[model samples]
Target chain A: MVMVPVVDYLRLEPEPHLCAHECTSCGARFFDRRNACAACGGQGFVDAAVATDAVVTAFTIVGFAAPGIEVPFVAAILDCGGTTVQANLRNVTPDADHVRLGMPVRLTTFSMGEDTAGNEGIAFAFEPAEQGGNA
Target chain B: MSDDIYILGISMTRFGKHPDFDAVDLGAQAALTALADGDVAMSDMDVIGAGNLLGGPGGFGQMLQKQIGQTGVPVYNVQNACATGATALRTVIMAIKAGEADMGLAVGVEKLSGAGLLLGGSKAADRDTWTPSGRVGAIAPTDGRIGTITMPGVFAQIGMQYLYEQSYAGVPLELFARISQKNHAHSTLNPLATYQKELSLEQIMGDFMVAYPNTRPMCSANCDGAAAAVVVSGDRLATMSAEQRRRAVRIRASVLTSDPYTEGCQVLFDVNTLTRRAAEAAYAQAGVGPRISISSSCTTASRPPSWCTTTT
Candidate 1:
């Protein structure tokens, strides 16, 4: 089965992880490809793989959404060491009781769907991991 | 030095649903009322500025001029995010400061009622180039898709991030609800507010959650409204009747700023940094300090000393 990655930064080859465009000057990391660093506007960048393990820094369980969207899902910002990302928290209840700040999570993959041409779409998410992830 | 700008009169239509009037009608109504409030005839104005967020085709200022008056004077129409009204006023103030005109009028109108929220659709994470179809209106959407750009989600993340950074037990939810309760309570005295009734903390916390920690009541409501102000150069006001000079309010210092580069700004989008920077510059310009406990007419009296007064 041919699998297609969801976002450009998501890499499935070396394992399911995210790649960051680290700014050469000021060391700012951006997930999306950049013409220059957002923090410093420096024109140079270094490709770096983000840590797979992370801790929840901030989160919100959205109950309202637009058309074609599902209600009641946990959207979170995770701190992978020094870098931060926006992702969904899976394998846990979408509530304050189950999801929280500093909750340990690890990068994982899920199938979005297979295209009509037999190409399967794969997206990355952070699922509930054991205790002691990134601080 | 250029003459200081002063607000001779200010007024607004009731902030609620206006079933009959469009944006232009509302703006004209507010502008007429402001002229009456200032006791200044439309012919007495030399310049005008109008602001509208979704102000349809054709210039809103000229359309407003059709309703108010068209003296063939300079008319500026502007829109700047949520600051459309303030920017419109600034346009007129700038005209006056340039010594081009002594008196100018500014009106801001928006028919938000019956208008759909701008919370459009999400795009594919990996796609760089955007297709109009990919942006909005898709079925079976995920919260992760809309979390990046939507206001409810952005504010929720911002609040939660602050708490998380302060180690508030995984983004303490109570703090956010408390803010809503305070806003509702303050609205009780404001006649122009759509909802003047105070809401309890329990009610706010129990309301339907739009984003985690922020309930339905916490989100912004789309209401139809228009407000206008008559701005006159202080030098001009002094030459007018004593009553006009007595009632005019002085503008201390008006400043606008955009987000500047800061560490981790890419992640959280620091809303506070620009505010802090603006406040510091305003304080220095106005000769004010953190000790001045200032509050708006409709705002509550209680607040901390200041938020980030130091220069970054």
Candidate 2:
């Protein structure tokens, strides 16, 4: 099966890691390019990689969505190191009792839908980390 | 040049589904109502600023003017997402302040219902083609893992984060419910508001969940409506009749600022930071103190509690 990233920010191969850019001057990280550091107005930056393992800072279970899309899915903001990534929480039931703040999570991928050519589209998500194991 | 700006007339259509009317129709109706309210003829207007986030066949200002009879006045179309209305008003104010026009009109209209399938179409193909790919000439990421989350989902995540970090006495969800309850109650006093019936905290909490931690009541409803205002310079106000002058409201200050890049650091991306900066600048320009009252359409549970002190 072939996989494609939903956004350019995610990298699927060689262990799923997010592609990010870090400002050389102030150490600010961004999922996209920053011609100049917004924090310090510095013009230099370098490519950076963000790990899949993250801690849930905040999350929600959306109960309404468009057609063909399931409701009550977990959408969350995860804190990976100092950078935050807005993604979905998976491998867990979408309910208040199942999801908790500060829960450790690891990057995972899923199939979105297939194209006319039968190509499966993929996107990234975070799942609950196993006990004493990396996500 | 410390020239004062005053709003001579203000009008808004009832906020509800208006399937029959498009953006232009709504804008024209509101503009006409405002002109009537101010007792100012449309011919007296020097310029018009029209704002709309979603409108078919652009040049909405010109289309609206066509309905009201065009006088060949310059019509500027403004689009800034949620800030469309305020941006339109600000544009007219700046033009007047620059001595471009003594009397100007600003109108904002929206027809979300007319957007049809595009309103919440979540199909991967639909989103991939319509939404920006982040980089030019590149396909946007289509990972299923990210899926499609709406604004409520985004705010709900922020709300959850605030609940975990802040030390509040009551249940965090209750706080959000209280906000919805208060806003709904306040809307009852506003005839132009979409939902005017008061809602209890329990009722708000019981409403269908649009996003976890955010019920339907906590979210803004999609409604078609338009609002308009006539703004004039101090000199123009002085020349108006006593009745028109008495109805004029002073616009002490107007400021617009863009959000700063947070380097994906959602924790530091508190909108209050931008609000505080803009508020401080506005107060300084208006020569007002922190004691002044404030009314804002943007309200989220993630907003700092300190903001409540400024909001009525």
Candidate 3:
């Protein structure tokens, strides 16, 4: 098991934004990027990023793994405003005790590991606003 | 009933674990078998619908076609998790029904044993925390979030709910075993089946539990195999003799749907309901009902609730 530095995803500048298809005709919003608006077949869309703050809608503390990595981290579905994004919560221990639905959170980055071919693969992580703000 | 498109022939490799073969190898075997079974040449195929659960990188469809020496046929890859095989079949049937092509083929190959599920290069504890269960490690969310519950947990919750609702404290462990037994029996009948020796209930139950109430045998084997079918339109069907056409199975219906939103519950259960709706639509299109005498039709009943989870 190798210990690697993990970073938050948003700080990676040019962080991938969640694209939503907006209907010009009916004013409907959809998560997937589409050529034509599903509601009105209008070719309209707006680039949207996960809101800076979100809630830990649901999370699971992972106890299963290989070696060298810390046990029990949280992976959460953050509902920022109206959109829900899946991200890993960092800093605090990932368990039922520390995480809660609707808890305020912010975008961050983390380190993943070496890739399949052995290249370093860094990742973006999210953390609770209260804990991450000081650092 | 009137729209043409008939399955002229079908073939499948014995499903089982094969570390030696890649998905393309399995796909090619099924493709060749279907071609031979239908007495149709590979050169006659107008299109190829190749379905795979875990398609490898670097243009999988072309790679699959290259294996069978049938390159350059507009190869279409249809991937949709466990239902991949049937969805590939539907793609070919729809092509024929739409009159886009008179003769088409669909092939599905899965090489589960080729390599364990790709988990981000993390340690066992990390994988365990992400996966929580199963020998195949869970892929950590490198995208930077934790508590991303995997499908096993989702389906486990579903089973839990079913348990609570049904009030059967016995657990559905036996149901999974029964399923494994039935499939294993079917496999034994299949000469190409990966596992020939049938396991006893004790054996199935005794195998390491991957998820609660779901053991190794009770769950679908993670093996490498391929299935294929050739479909031709009725216009071409009339040219063939009664004996040649007797084996043709018609496509009564095909439907696909996705979850609109997550209401904090597993969406896997909705698949059967949606599939049933599609079947109803297909039945109306064919002017047939459940009361009508029919030879055979596949159902979602073969799907374990766990397989339907979005995250598996």
Give the clashing residue pairs of candidate 1, or none: A7-B126, A8-B126, A68-B139, A68-B140, A68-B141, A69-B141
The DockQ-based CAPRI class assigned to model 2 is acceptable
Better of 2 and 3 by DockQ: 2
User: What DockQ does candidate 2 score?
Assistant: 0.47
Residue range A10-38, candidate 3, lDDT tens digits: 32346533333445665555543356754
Clashes of each: 6, 9, 46
Local distance difference test, each candidate: 0.74, 0.73, 0.57
DockQ of 1: 0.43
List where candidate 3 sits over 4 angstroms from the true fold: A1-135, B55-57, B67-72, B118-151, B172-186, B260-262, B265-272, B286-312
User: For each candidate, what's the DockQ?
Assistant: 0.43, 0.47, 0.09
Stretches > 4 Å off in candidate 2: A1-6, A33-44, A110-123, A130-135, B114-144, B167-170, B265-270, B296-312
Interface RMSD of candidate 3?
9.6
Better of 1 and 2 by lDDT: 1
Per-residue accuracy of model 1 over B1-312 as CA lDDT, tens digit each: 546789998889998888888889889889999998888978989999888877354599998888778888899989876667878888998898889989999998887776544553544453332212222222223345524445677678777777776766533556777777877787898899888988888888888987777787777677888899999998888888888888888887666777887755766567777877777776786788768825222111111101212222
Between candidates 1 and 2, the one scoring higher on DockQ is 2
